[model samples]
Target: MNAQAPHATGRQALFANLLFWGMLLVGGGALAACMLVPAWLDYQAARQAAWAAHARNDALARRITAQQLQIAHHQRDPQYNERFIRQEFRIPTPGVQVVTVEADPTGIVAPADDAERAHRPAEPVFPAKALATARRSPLLAVFVLDQTRPAVMALAGALLTGALCLISGPRRS
Candidate 1:
């Protein structure tokens, strides 16, 4: 009986040790899997978002190109500036003057005749080059797209860091 007791004690001790190690391994594996799996999901999401952003940027580039083509077409026309001025400012040409005739005596104004307008020289054409220069720079869209990349990277990096922290942290208690 005494010999059997010792043998049983030894077996019990071995079982206890095995259980402890098994629990440690299982717990650690679960922790690691939990952390890593979520991180992978986040990475995938970020990659998809980045791809979509790239598509959007490409579309924007196409839109800008179309706008540039339209602008070029307008610029190529010799009378574009003249039409623009006439439509925008409602300014009459030098020979075609605007005459005002006041119905009331209180207003002092008189309408002029066609002979005065005939002597006047034609209105000079307005140049578009100066207006183009005054407009905003074309590189602004590229700069904005360039700036967004870092922010997207930062978001994905943060998610990875958080997942790592969860995996490395001590179990429940």
Candidate 2:
């Protein structure tokens, strides 16, 4: 008689159950990781982006503040008036001597003439109110916006959804 050892009782059932539980554990772990990792990464990226935006906003604010200070200083100084006049009118400074010497190819020296520069144009005054008005444009409502918050939640939700799909099995048709 051919003899064989009897199969262990309930071994097939045990194996099936073990396999199902193992698959569940592994699948669940993968799903959880897929969800968690991207969320974490997205959160980090969003945080960094927000910080960068905040830095940019702060820099712009500081620049605006500095410009305001400059305007205030100019209002108190008359030299700024002269400078602005020079810029606005393209006028050269009076009483400042500019000497130019011409050299002859034949080794002859030509002396610079002071007579041509003896007479200088008078400087004109500019309206300060225009400059003040230009400086005040920043205080207008059109120049500002509410940048204290930005839209980043959509990015987080999208990442979470993509991760969930990746970890979960495909749906049956």
Candidate 3:
């Protein structure tokens, strides 16, 4: 009986360790879900806001570039400037007679023209230049833990060694 006691005790210890470890894993997983899920969601929201800001900034930059080009055009082209002044500003030239035409009120009265104009595409808030491909994430890669740290490496090595020992069990003489 004394000769077998060591092996019997070893088996019991191993069983207890396994049962305890299993329970710890289950509890740890639940705790992680409770804590980490909300944090991850918040992180996602922040990331989205950051991306939106970038989109707005890009759109503004493109708008600025277009405005600069327009200013350049206005400065360089006398024909464009004159046409823009005449058409856009409604400024009459010195002698050019302008004609005004209106739809005959006596003709068949049509319904409000809102429906026809509704089909015209609305202006986009963000320009196509500002749009980015929907990738996994526009932000930098994120990690829950720093894997490169010496402490982390040591911990991983220890866990691996312990797992190997657990799997092998007590060595037989």
Give the number of the best model, judged by lDDT. 3
Error of 3 at 79 (Å): 3.4
TM-score: which candidate is best? 2
Query: Candidate 3, residues 71-101: lDDT per residue as tens digits?
Result: 9988999998788788888887887997889
Ranking by TM-score: 2, 1, 3
Q: What's the lDDT for residue 137 in model 2?
A: 59
Please report, in order, the local distance difference test score of every candidate based on alpha carbons.
0.55, 0.51, 0.57
Q: In model 3, what are the clashing residue pairs, if there are any?
A: none
TM-score of each: 0.42, 0.46, 0.42
Pick the winner on lDDT between candidates 2 and 3: 3
Poorly placed runs, candidate 2 (over 4 Å): 1-7, 10-14, 95-173
Report the C-alpha displacement of residue 126, candidate 1, in angstroms: 53
Ranking by lDDT: 3, 1, 2
Evaluation by TM-score, superior candidate among 1 and 2: 2
Model 2 residue pairs with clashes: none
Q: What value of lDDT does candidate 2 attain over all alpha carbons?
A: 0.51
Backbone clashes for every candidate come to 0, 0, 0
Query: Which of the two candidates, 1 or 2, achieves a greater lDDT against the reference?
Result: 1
Structural RMSD, model 1: 20.3
Regions of model 3 farther than 4 Å from truth: 1-14, 80-173
